[model samples]
Target: MAGTETHYTLPRPTFDEAPKLLIVVAPYYKDIADDLIAGAKAEIEAAGATWEIVEVPGALEVPTAIRIADRTADFDGYVALGCVIRGETTHYETVCNDSSRALSTLGLAGLCIGNGILTVENRDQAVVRAAVDQQNKGGGAAAAALHLIALGRKWTGGEKQVGFRPVGA
Candidate 1:
């Protein structure tokens, strides 16, 4: 038999110092939402940051909460969690498109939003994706925030910290 190949896994990124995290959640799918929040909290804690959770009505409200939170300059970054399952009408498309756009605009302005708003076809898919697995999207979003912050530090001449406090606020 041929020898089996082995692969080495890398360690998760650790901050030089822990930063604060603001989490915005849309409780459309309670089960999925709870799971996502748990995964995100665990990752944030592991990275040595304090985390706070805020609840909104549903996916339609996530981006707005993120934008509002962005105005505060309170946390280093943010994570948005919600589930949008497609239906017969195009309402799903509209929500997904709009939410994604708003989040991107916030990110461009130096507010790192994880954008974990799940647009799945059904509840089962949402459940499977939100938990503490290797592919947990919530955990992935938390990691995204951490990575973006690191990249920001590189770009800002070693400033290493950025608060929201959007202009004209």
Candidate 2:
């Protein structure tokens, strides 16, 4: 069974300079959000990184807040945390897709973002995922962001200018 399978986790990364990260959370489910935040914060601190937290209304706002921070804040990375339990309506799909898309777009645009938003069938699944003793999705997300930040730093000196060059003057 998938549940009995062992998952391979990447080795935790170390950094010469402490990375600063912003954690944006949608606390629609307060308990779950709190658990996620705890896990994420622990992971960040374990990596010798600093982080700040901001609360949004719901899952949809998590990415939006991250984008805003990316534009105005000096954080090296961002962690997006939230839970979206499937309901009777189609709102679940909309929230999941849009939030995921926005985060992906921002990541592609050069922002280091860890997306921990949970889209599960019920609260039980969310609880397990958020628990630090369990899946610890929050920690997984933070680790992802840290890895991306490391990659970004690794390539910083090799950045090439890309744009149209006025017809080779």
Candidate 3:
């Protein structure tokens, strides 16, 4: 089974200047959400970064909160956490696809984001993936954000101008 296979993880990254992050979570499943939050927080702290958290109503709102924070807050990166289990209707697919697309769009727009939202077929799957000692997808998401933040710092001051400049004498 996939669970029994070995996988490679990148070495934990560090930063010269402490980074500030925002964690946005949807607590539809409170227990699952709590577990994800714990794992993400642990990883962020271990990387010597500080984080703030906000809870949204559901998975669809997680990205919106991140975008709001990105626009008006000073966080260096964001971690999105939630759990969406398949239901009898098609709502599950909509939530999964839209939330993911929104986050991806923000990421492409140069906002450092780690997407930890879990879309699973059942509660059992969500439990396994959310466990800190198991899949630990939350930690994985935090790591992703950290890595992107590191890259952003590395390229900061080295960016080339791309468009028109103000008229000079």
| Candidate ordering by TM-score (highest first) | 2, 3, 1
lDDT of 3 at 161: 77
* Best prediction by TM-score: 2
Which regions of candidate 3 deviate over 4 angstroms?
165-169
User: Model 2, which residues run further than 4 Å from truth?
Assistant: 166-169
Cα lDDT of candidate 3 equals 0.93
Per residue, candidate 1 scores C-alpha lDDT tens digits across 45-136 of: 88787788999997878878877777766888898888899999999999899888888888988887787888988777787778776347
Give a tens-digit lDDT track for model 3, residues 73-107: 89999999999999999999999999999999999
C-alpha local distance difference test of each model: 0.79, 0.92, 0.93
| lDDT ranking, best first | 3, 2, 1
TM-score of the candidate numbered 2? 0.95
Q: How much does candidate 1 score in TM-score?
A: 0.82
